[model samples]
Target: MSLSNIANDPNKRMILFGGKGGVGKTSISSATAIYLAEQGDKVLIISTDPAHSLSDAFSQDLSGGEVIQIEGVDGDLCGLEISPEKGTEEVKHMLEEEGVSDELNQSLSMLGLDDLTSDLHQNTPPGMDEAVALSQVMQIARQGDYDRIILDTAPTGHTIRLLSLPEFLDSFLGRLLKMRVKLSNTLAFFKSMVGMEAEKDRSVEIMEKLKENILQIREDLQNHTETEFVVVSIPTLMSVYESERLLVALTEQNILVRNVVINQIMPRNESCPFCSARYHSQQEVLEYARQVFSDYVQTELPYLAEEVKGVEKLRKLASMIFSDA
Candidate 1:
């Protein structure tokens, strides 16, 4: 499929740009959002990476949890830089609001669950940032406020973890819920034998709802018609290998990769020896990428002298990425 076709597709509601760091994922994601917005679609571009470059790419000072509209754009284009710290806090606040932590603590008090509950709130796991970010993404996607939601994700490893977190959480929660249900049943049986009434456990209901939300997000992610993954890489050996790994990981999770963008291609300027040598080296890597990702649509972005920032530079990048020529 052509770049224009992918960009203009009505069914493509979510677009994810991810690859190794320093491969221009942020710039490409920003440009794509601009392109889609300019086409009259309301677009919101968000950065899930803790080290946010979306603000830098757009030359705008965007804060966490707030969407800022880009100036000089004819269409509606908003940007957000998700602060992982803020996201973690928000997740905690949400659990508190839902009384999940409190309910679980009260229900499991017999088993010394206070420590576990404290650990949950105090000690976040290694991939908790990504988990929080994914939760935020799901929340935004469900809001239906924008025609297209563009995500500029973290580097390859984190992105893969983020993509797989829903399944992991779903399974983990299921097992926990089962255990809780069995324990509740046993307790209720003992209470009935003693001629006492047992109250319905609300923790199970909360777990069920959590599982439902996870399943819904997973479904949305796996919907090929509505979601698209774009892997960005430069013409280099390491980049090619990383991109291959990323694609394989996504494929394993049944996520459809719609495109592979090879950024920073050397121009065909053979006058200089260094440029000539770099071009040849890049061509070899490019050919390898073509063979490896032949099943997916591939596009290349030329190396520009100036760093791609601000509206004009991003517009030029968008044209290069989506242009038929």
Candidate 2:
């Protein structure tokens, strides 16, 4: 099974593991990152889910802003959990620079806007996490520090917002930036008349950088060779249907999704009626997935006897998924 073309395609720089919540995407993404790192590729795994689980999957505290090197992995693997709250703080700090914070604050204070823009992240619209996560991807990709980037994305609905955000955010931000530039010009003119120097247009700088990142993100994500998405799901009616919706949505966005992971496939216990019935129900969904999702490569991950945590378990999981090559 071509589970994200990791072993097969050397050109794919970004791979995203996403699906319904609690579908083992974190485990899969961490395993894949381990696999690539062991293969001598510098790999970084990032968790975009606000409910970060990379720490639990690897038994480490990855909730911090800095990238943490994963212990006990076979190769060069580092992990980061990017939080929207953290991104917002970074923006606030940029706006309030060293030695400039006091003056900038006083200026805005006189303008009677300091209180409103003080905690900027609070006023950000809904789904800012998705936008922030995508921005992180663009930032990382631009840096060229890692050979491969493995993303453990949010659940289905939020992930859709992330994948489709490039174009929508690009256009929306474009218009917004235009209006802001006009306002900045007006402010600059007024400042000149008052015999005062105009404060630097920091928002324009940040927004322009964001616009550039969004455009690059869109181009890279749409290119099949540069990016791939693996949908992780379980053999159940609800999860399977949602996986189908995720697949269709990806196709519509022109993002590449060449692999489907059907996690937690259970075995039948002949003596227990409940086990047998559950297996039957799961089998039906498996077969349905085989037909509807036939266009992409499909792989089955059996239900683990224990939680797949720490390095040993993750390495084992990686063997099962990527050992096909």
True-vs-predicted CA distance for residue 173, candidate 1, Å: 1.5
For model 2, how does the per-residue alpha-carbon lDDT over 35-154 read when each residue is reduced to its tens digit?
899988999999876676898999999987679998898789999998876775665566455322454445556666565344343455445566667778768876999889998888
lDDT of 1 by residue, 1-325 (tens): 3477677687899998899989999999999999999998999999976676887888878766688898877799998888877777876676667665454576566666555456556775445677677768879988999999999988898877766766666665665676577667877897899998976555557656655765677788889998988999999999999999999999987888978999999998789999999999999999998899898888888999999999899999998888972
Model 2 residue runs over 4 Å out of place are 2-4, 92-123, 174-205
Clashes of each: 0, 0
Any idea what lDDT model 2 has?
0.79
Q: What C-alpha lDDT values do all the predictions have? A: 0.81, 0.79
Error of 2 at 98 (Å): 13
lDDT of 1 at 89: 83
Give the TM-score (vs. native) of candidate 2: 0.82
